[model samples]
Target: MSLDRPAGKVPLLELEGLVKHFPFRDSLGRRRGAVHAVDGVTLAVPRGSVLAIVGESGCGKSTLGRVALRLVEPDAGSLRFDGEDLLALRPAALRAKRREMQLIFQDPFASLDPRMTVEAAITEPLILHRLHRGRERARVAELLERVGLRPELARRWPHEFSGGQRQRIAIARALASEPRLVIGDEPVSALDVSVQAQVVNLLGDLIRDLGLTFVLISHDLGVVRQVADRVAVMYLGRIVEEAPAEQLFLTPRHPYTRALLAAVPGQGGALKLLEGDIPSPVSPPSGCRFRTRCPHAQALCAEVVPELMGDAGRESAGQAAHLTACHFQDSLPPATPIREAAADARLARLQSFFSTNREPTA
Candidate 1:
């Protein structure tokens, strides 16, 4: 959570120029335009740190998470994990690499097999990786306990557990392989507000205690604020801003990011609210995808695509640089503090609950 950590170290996972598109076909079976799910996204997650990718629904946050783990093949990109080329790996080699990376999906109900008992579900990974061998049950029990669930619940069916408990089981399954990196796509979004905090606290503890690198994909800014070390703000399949969690929340540079924070209930700011719906990904705006809704958009915004550039003027000594994709980020009017007298103070109280040293409970 500290912004003072020095940057420039090699990351555990590095993705560059990543692109994934889902093409459709006409009645004649001929190919039509593709849905630009992820376009030219480059991001890095340092070892033992948490990077949260935040955006509204359909901005390609989930697709980016899947592509990062190679569950979805990218049309173009360079992906390196632990300093190795991920794209060049053969199927068999990629299967082997799966042991080091896992995903905790969004819907726990769909993620778990109804017929499979809790133990069987959690042990599947150990079986696939040829781990724990004859000790699979023991390992499953240990994993169950680690995620703050009772080991005895291993025999229960997925349908028998509550939403939060199912998510804990999903977490246990993700960690069964003892992965070096885990991508959680909306991991706690479906849970109740109180339950979300419990799961977030558990994840924070596991990431810290076990030194696991994590990439969180979620729209819940409160959850992101509670656990993320850094945050990437995505819009229309592209990242518009990236900065340390505290810095981004305090001084967002991109118009899209500022609007997002301002839209949060009880937060007051001078920024204009976004006016229109998000443009279809199949045919996004020519240049800046967000220009259509951005109040600061000018004629130049429609002609030239803005590149993500570091804000050198705002960087503090030894802190990670804040990067913004707005062409006139420097020339733009300064942002007023978004916090208002009636600002949602509950978020801070909620964050403190999950961020403390107290142990997680069921």
Candidate 2:
């Protein structure tokens, strides 16, 4: 059933100066280095909205999502959920509070227990949370149908389903507890292009109808654009730009954000891909982490780190809060259009295939 509650203005999830690092040792147990996975990430997620964290694979977007849930602990920083300090909670308290938040992993196959049937996988959370005790089977069937699967399929094993079906099952398991906040760590990246759309649409319906707050960690700009209400562009473990989704794409202030949008297919000119791989987090570049690949980087960029500044003076009320961490955000050149006229027809066909055959939202 669709949730009847309306989204509130208060932030549901807040992260302030969050930092997480992993120390590595050599084969002989000698200290080697530390991987600075999530470094000083501060952001607010309002209740019942979708906030997407987009960037390249090694940029620590995934790590940030995991840290929020305490699946991986942070070395430093404050984590607050619904006005409570998550980091300050005791182990027992934290575990009890977990029902309010949940994670939908990227690899559906690896995330599920192979031995468990679809019903068992989805029912486990209900048992743990002790909800609908006498009617657990009815709850499982309802969840399966909610995620676009047949109730009869609940008895099937994970391997018996298709890639898309497995992902649907994973989502059903995550929603079993009726979490208020859901973090999808590259949830649809593993599926084929055709299947990705179906999952994306399903997620959109769920978020809107259920009034659930979502944190989507992904590298796909198209998927991000389709579902996100706001976008946060991450580079080397820090947010470089954040704005309403349309504003971010239409007027990207960060050089890194521009390069990502420019690379999208059918969007018009030559692909302006960011040069070079991401720097090692163990020894990241000084000053600005993106300076190594930014075409507009100058000597000052290397000498001083830039803070994420808002565009209060230049933008109107709603969009004025757009933030960028570039020293020369005002001087950055406009992006060259990258969409091709020839690609429009193909893009339309692709869109149609994914939009069709999905169950209507309740």
Candidate 3:
């Protein structure tokens, strides 16, 4: 399923100057300030790549995913999919274009319709797009098996399945339209740890087998490390750093990114905890949103915003440039590197556990 895409083609998905804000109002109907969910996000996802957006709760990771799929429209920005302008598509055109994109929601428990059987649920997409017109049940059965569920289970109710199975069904439904891009918003977070590993492995296999351009939104670094090709670290609705997963984990340049890595269990660096609570998105800190919690904050960090800096010519061809947004990144003290051997060993153990047939370990 992994196709060789032509070189220098337009990205499968591209977002620029994206902005979304939720406004609150009193009973008086006066509009209070808005919650700045996403502000000026720009990124590209090449075909067949897994781009993970990682951040703490309310940092706009999920919002960005929703916006990318246009499930929640952005207040401002340009969205291009396969060189076509998504934002400019008319309503009917947008609906037709939606067949190429889909979303797997965070909570599998609530994602399914309680009233609908698994067959009906998965068949909804087929009906919407007028696909497999006379053989919907067979299609549902195929989808169930694709996600590692029994074909017989299609007739069962969602409540009859466990959390992991429910998530598998959700995955099947998202793929019913055979979308080219899928945004998984914390798809594994609601499941238990053992189940999480199984779902993560399934997702990885599907991405490789289906050649999906996937966007995974999660705060779980372990899962991100396992599946992501590119990692974007978001803070207070702004991306602080983005790079290839290995480069970001091994040589994180932004102080915020370093602190996040330091908190991982096997990172083998002196813990570098962020000092303060994240600033409220309603009124995020000026200049740099992370300066409030960033250990390397200086007078300049308060006065001016830093652009995401990277040398385009330095990286090997075809590898993404490692970009970090910090004015003093060059002058800041070098971060302690994560011990590679320990990290590799831990990752190896995790992969082994995922591959084994034995019951999941506690």
For each candidate in the order shown, give its overall lDDT on alpha carbons: 0.90, 0.88, 0.89
* CA deviation > 4 Å runs, candidate 3: 1-5, 266-270, 316-319, 339-362
Winner on TM-score between 2 and 3 is 3
Residues 21-101, candidate 1: write the lDDT tens digits.
Answer: 999999999999999999999998888889999999889999999999899999998999989999999999999999999
Q: Runs in model 1 with CA error above 4 Å?
A: 1-9, 268-271, 340-362
Deviation in angstroms for 23 in model 1? 1.2
Q: Enumerate residue pairs that collide in model 3.
A: none
Q: Give the clashing residue pairs of candidate 1, or none.
A: none
Candidate 2 per-residue lDDT, tens place, 1-362, comes to 11222545458899999999889999999989898888899999888888999999778999999899888889999899999999889999998889989999999999999999999999999999998899999999999999999999999999999899999999999999999999999999999987998899899999988989999999998899899988999998899998888789887889889888887766555467778888998998999999999989999999899999886666655333689999998877786644535758767766665456865443
Kindly give the stretch of ten consecutive residues in candidate 2 with the minimal lDDT sum.
1-10
TM-score of the candidate numbered 1? 0.92
lDDT of 3: 0.89
How much is 326 displaced in model 3, in angstroms?
0.7
Model 1 worst lDDT window (10 residues): 1-10
Please provide TM-scores, in order, for all candidate models, with all chains considered together. Answer: 0.92, 0.91, 0.92
Worst 10 residues of 3 by lDDT: 1-10
